[model samples]
Target: MRLTRPFRRLGPAERRIWDAYPTGAWVDLRTGDKDTDDPVNGPAWGPDRTVRAEVIAALLLGAREPEPGRTAGLRLAGARVTGELNLSDAVLTGKLHLLNCHLSEVVSLTDATTSGVRFRGCEMERIRAARCTVNGLLELDGSTVRNGVRLDNAHVTGQFRLSRARLHAPGERFRASESWLEDARRPFTAAEMKERGLGQDQWAVWAGGLTVDGGAFLRDLRVTGGLRLIGAKFHGGIYLQRSVITATGSHAVQADFMEAGAVEFSAGFTAKGTIRMRSARVNGVLSFSEATLEAPGRTLHLSHAQVEELIWLPTSVKGGVNLGYSRIGVLFDGPASYPDEVRLNGLTYEALRGRWTVAERLSWVCRDSDGYRPQPYEQLAAWFRRIGHEPDARRVLLAKQRRRRGTLRPTGRFWGRLLDLVVGYGYRPWLAGLWVVVLLAAGTAVFAAVPPAQIDPDEVRSFQPFVYTLDLLVPVSVFEQRGAWEPVDWTQWLAWTLVASGWILATALIAGAARVLRPSAGS
Candidate 1:
């Protein structure tokens, strides 16, 4: 095929080629337009108004190459353009890309792909597409999107790389609910790559360092292999509710520094593979309420990360959500914020059956000015009761009371003295009584041995037996007649009898008292 005239526009010859070839075989030509000036415009310019609509349509239907340097816009809807659609540097102000380009084989856009199909550096006001499919990789590194990029249900068989791309407006939503990426390869090598789990020949999403100013949402994306977002920053919240990632691959999502209002990984979804979020900071709550992580050694390492709100792992979840050293602020209240403030009610550790330690260094930065307020003792006691640790809780309460007593009114000097006495000489009372009894008995015995001072022998002899008897019978008479009656002779028997009787009575009284007061072994 040769061009008769200077190929300034698409003609009937090119139109026939487009109509003859399959949709996948239509190769897009580079039009050498800078995308920096206007983000949405494609590189190529279509034919003029003089060309018939039917002819222009035919030219773009499935043609390998459009007329070189055309000045008209191309509209190919459902053309089933096959093979590699090389729109490397084409400029199209209108919607240059269509819904779906039917591909019997693979496709390639070494560095760029767009709804308006721009190449190099071109600017377009708007780019819109509902559903598209590329059999091969879609590479658009260093590209810029202006208003909005919409790719709702696009299917790409190979790896998707949009690293270092800037989205001024809200970026496209890759809601590839039913799309699949089969037999894909990693865009970046293993060493330079910060992400993992790229299958040997499986689909992958590589968007490392891609910045979205107005935020991006991946609502229900189902990636067959790994989805890498190493160092990607999202300004708005990212929701991954009810999404499933299979076990054949390693990582399901690898987004670090994922700062936003909130990030959810709930709704009973299972990640048989690992989910790595090392050093990822979540400004708001990071919820994994009922999600299950099936991988045994898989970890969600957020060490040294800061969370303004809670990092909730409610008791309903099955797998352990390790928050080893991460600092989390207030916890969740309900489905939203409850208690008019962030509470720790929804925060749980049901899955943490084994041993774990909370980081001592990092303190939670609470939003309330009063600072990190720990739960009240009563609340903790109730919680312990519910968990069957009430005794422990009661012990803590008693310990607190003792501490208060020690602090408020300490013991005085008098108490100190009493304590000393009790510890030292308290047992002396019983010993002192025993010694007194022994001394009394010894004095009695000594008196009994010494015969009463012998009354004068002459006086005794003078006293007649009758007089002596009368005197003894009446003690008053003996005192009165001390001069008249002769002094009775001091008899050893009488003295001994009196001393022994007196000692016996005193000993009996002492023994009775001792028996009554002293503690017995059996008692």
Candidate 2:
């Protein structure tokens, strides 16, 4: 049960708002320059511009009921609100707009249900609206909150706008009573603090599990601490264009497991710490075009997420980016936009939307800092093959083999190098045929110049040097002249070389043919 407020006890500003509430009129209490007289810390305003928070709360809660058949609302501009506006668990049918007002204490709207709520250009310490429900737009556009805004588990039926808002979060402090040292019977050190999860609670927007029916417009917003949206759901997408977020934790924008239609972190967006979106799903495009991310370690973490289209054209990145295990429908990227270190293991995409050459695209695959990963190469090759660029697909597969060769032992590497020189790991099968022709011609020329003595002088027909040479070079004796002929001196050594070369060439040809026949054999 709440206390009633009589009209007789209302101050000049409160009485004016009470009378105008029945008509839903705009009560502008601004006198001169509002900037010169900052309502948060300036000299006390006269009665005309000062309203007690209790009177406004009473009107909003129906303790001081308006006339029947009239739509009652509270709309004030440039007023100084004294005391805390505690509207916890209240149901308000009217729309509330407090434009350019200065709220002195914490505005607690915990578990309240309202038609709409707008605090545009208002200055407040903080807002505690945990579990609140808004039917229409819940906007804090252009407002400055010194502490932060907490809307954890809240639901909004309409758009949630916070464009151009400034949020300076109150950083985490040491709670000595809850220290792990007392529990563990040890001294508290930095290592202990890290192991025990003793850290600061500096979050600009703690909206975990928040559900928005419409879009979340956070464009041009500035946050001094982390923006956490863990498990939040946005139907109409999230726009973070031109926003600046800086924080001291592991992630500046921690949005793990969140789901949205689309997410635009583009158009001059800057984050001073990691922007982690682990396991998040977006049904539409997730863009980072022309954005900047600067962190000490991993800059953009998109592991295990699923997105329709991923537009990755960041202006700059100070740290690494991880896209491991993510599935994308289409990926649009630029050659020079990638960071020095990247993680692309288990990443899959249906189509690559770019005009870059195969070499440039392969460079993107080479940026993986965790040595060689075969999946990225295979995925690139598959995409190229789908688009009828068969040669480019072979090039990607050839590079994959070359990268894999680096990790082999000396004996394996020797065999790999021989295969590469002879057949290009079967990606260039024509090289093997060309080598066979060259070696055949060289062998033909060597034996034709110096004739070999006949091993069985009286047994066979005349010694044909070309047929004898062919028999020496072929792994199987198809010509039947090698047994009848014998070579001496340097020609004898050449005959032995031809036999060994024949076996190597035959083995290489068979291996190359097998690989070409089944392209996914070794892969």
Candidate 3:
């Protein structure tokens, strides 16, 4: 076994780790909580449980030669590692397993390739592994990272896990005095931790362009800053069940342009800032069920994405949710799940699953922030038509015309209202028939009371009041009474009024019927 330094210069704890390096045995130096434990109290650790990072790195990088068939690796626990573990650009064949250790400086694995790495229950300042590759699993479950973890453009052949982890943003400083660091009787309180810089609007996990062959499990993860995975590709899906991300004035989780399988952001998930997933592609379901999103600006922006199915039933949303220009195979949502403002323009869904009435669903479309958009109405109407609800589909189209009327000029609006009152924008054809019947009755009564003198007294046809009224009202057919009899004074005026009303009714009826009969004209 090779050594970076002579064995005579090694410390007691370092010598113990070196002796166990060849056999891959664990060098458990943990005694109690005060020995070398805790992330924030690393500065107060004694020399008994301390391990130099260079010594450990050298050993992992072929400093020690194992037996012919024995696997050699570093299995450390409960140690305070001083100095930086810079393994950048190195190809390591051995595995690294650290448990409950506290490393004071940043661990640089930039551009390095490793077999496997596990940091279970460990605490580190940061991990800078940009563009690195991992052949096996990279697990960090139950660990704490004070600054951040940057795995940008990295590729992992196995699973990348961070379940039950706590991560803070970069540039966070420990502001406690040296006297308090050594003489403090207990851990800092929550308020004191805030003063020590717990929250910052930086990237806690910037894994943009990362490609993971297996799943990225982030369940129960707690992050104090943004968790960005923009343009990442995950073949086995990304799970975030019960995760909580708090980053005010910035995006809490930004997975824009990400391609994944069954991304689950459900089950008690909470985020303080926006969760943007613009232009993403998901092979399976993307859910946010039982999640809580609160942001001053847009809470969710899922525009231009394509997903197989979507389950969006968040518990509460403080800011607006935008799903504009997206396409989904199936959608599951509810009225109570929607916020006051939403953007559904150009969003297309094949099937809808909910126990909501047509009115409630229409209300959902009306909540779009862009006022009245015809596409949303058309989309909803098409869904209704697909479900065999022809009347409900017409109702949606009618509402669309009513909303569009408000955007027109005064004369156009007047004409629109006339169409609405007469035919309900072609959706209610019976309204025109009802008006025709009512006007015909009134015209008959008026002509019966005030009969006019006959124009031709020698004509054989009789002056029938009801027949004359019918002749005046009907534009298509003419009765003989209209040619034989003439109306003067009040009767003449009533006849002229009936003829005008008849023309208007016939025109309206033709227009409404054509619109209803032809699907393209109705749309």
Candidate 4:
């Protein structure tokens, strides 16, 4: 509400106003009038009084302590401050609205506590608000900050609106270089530099480590350079609904270990670099529904995060979505292409959004290249069971069994592949029936071609080749046909093969039935 000591008797700030446009008049905060005389805005054609930055700040801080609704805060519009505007460590009880003001130097609100601050339609060089606390909304709507905007360690009680705000922080763009291992080559992956914490924060708009109690509304934000929000935490939902961040380096939105309720990177979010949200925890839905990411590999990495609600990643993803060891409630949907490379090693999603076949779901689960990871499969099966999709759950278990078999030793692999090839790990019961029919037909042909000596001559009235073949296949019962014939020479081999086929078919049918009825043990 009041300027403490040094800022109390602040000198007058200076600015020269031009007479070209309607807003081109020198506005003096001291006399509270527009002056058209001191001359420094332009050349001889300029007619404007010069104003100091401190003069503006001192006048805005008020001659006395600001009252509630009377003169609580500063509301200065279209006033150009020629020097650096320093409001650091100041306390303001009311909102500060600086509209359409142009400052030549950076504005420092470091460690300042204010109710709210709106720099709507203003253009400043830069902003340094480290450790500043805003009780209400901080609106940077339609403003242009040429240099970096640092809000590190700041806390906002209400929403932080950066909609239509143009923040410029030059990032290191990729250049065509010959060296592969050198630092001046292509983009350095965020994985390589995240440990050192040099990711996109050096020369960009860094709000890293800030905590917003309310939601962050950042729609249509165009950061020309890199934007880093590493370690930022939001208590309520954060909506970056439509923002285009084009960082040159590997890490564009370096929001590692962030904690938020619900986050929406939906609608028209195009990022050129990697949007790393690794080790972050989301309490609600983390939606990247309509984003266009140009990730080369694991660019959309959200590894080790715990998402309590749904996570939707539809539309465009040009790289891998690494969700290794993350716990998610439900996966609403995801990208189609490169699904096999999606890092879902230890993902735990309860239920999916859409109704997908068991095969489709298993196919996605099998995308991990580590052969057979039991936890993912078990998690999926448990989720399916919880949702009353028992049959699909069995299919998932069967898929896991087959995959596990594939990863086993030589003998186990052989049997696993054989079972998979024959009956889809005992999930497709009809395949076993088809194999039975095939073996029956094959046996019938061989038996009718080469007739054997009749072991039971009186049973000739029921000597049907097809019936005899089927009777040999069903191990549970027998007909008066197996002992009726004895094959000779090459036909003996055919009979033995038919017997083996019958055993395989019967075993497959029983195994399939058991698998369908029983729940998967591992998960």
Q: Which model, 3 or 4, shows the larger lDDT?
A: 3
What is the per-residue lDDT of model 3 for residues 1-523, given as tens digits with 9 covering 90 to 100? 3445544477778888787887888998777756436645656768878899998898888878775687888999888899999999999988899988899899888999999989988888899999999999998999999889999999999999999999987733343222321312344566755665543325789899999999999999998777888999999999999999876225788899999998998999998878999999999999999999887778899999999999999998888899999999999988898889989999999999978988898888888866888898888888889989999989988888888899899998997888889888778988978987787788777767877778877766656666777788787657766666778786677778878878877777777777667764343
Model 1's C-alpha root-mean-square deviation from the true structure amounts to: 23.6
Candidate 3 differs from the real structure by a C-alpha RMSD in angstroms, to one decimal, of 6.2
Q: Which of 3 and 4 is ahead in TM-score? A: 3
lDDT (C-alpha) at residue 420 in model 2: 86
TM-score order, best first, reads 2, 3, 4, 1
Best by TM-score: 2
Candidate 1 global CA lDDT score = 0.38
**Positional deviation of 253 in candidate 4, in angstroms?**
1.1
- Clash numbers, per candidate: 33, 1, 0, 7
Q: Write the per-residue lDDT of candidate 1 for residues 128-208, one digit (tens) a residue.
A: 332343344343334433333333334333434333333322211221223212211123466423233223222244445
Error of 3 at 255 (Å): 1.2
The total number of steric clashes, by the backbone 3 Å criterion, in model 1 comes to: 33
Q: Where is model 2 more than 4 Å wrong at Cα?
A: 1-8, 32-34, 37-44, 172-200, 519-521
Worst 10 residues of 2 by lDDT: 172-181
- Model 4, stretches more than 4 Å misplaced? 1-50, 56-63, 67-69, 170-203, 308-315, 334-340, 354-363, 366-410, 437-486, 506-518, 521-523
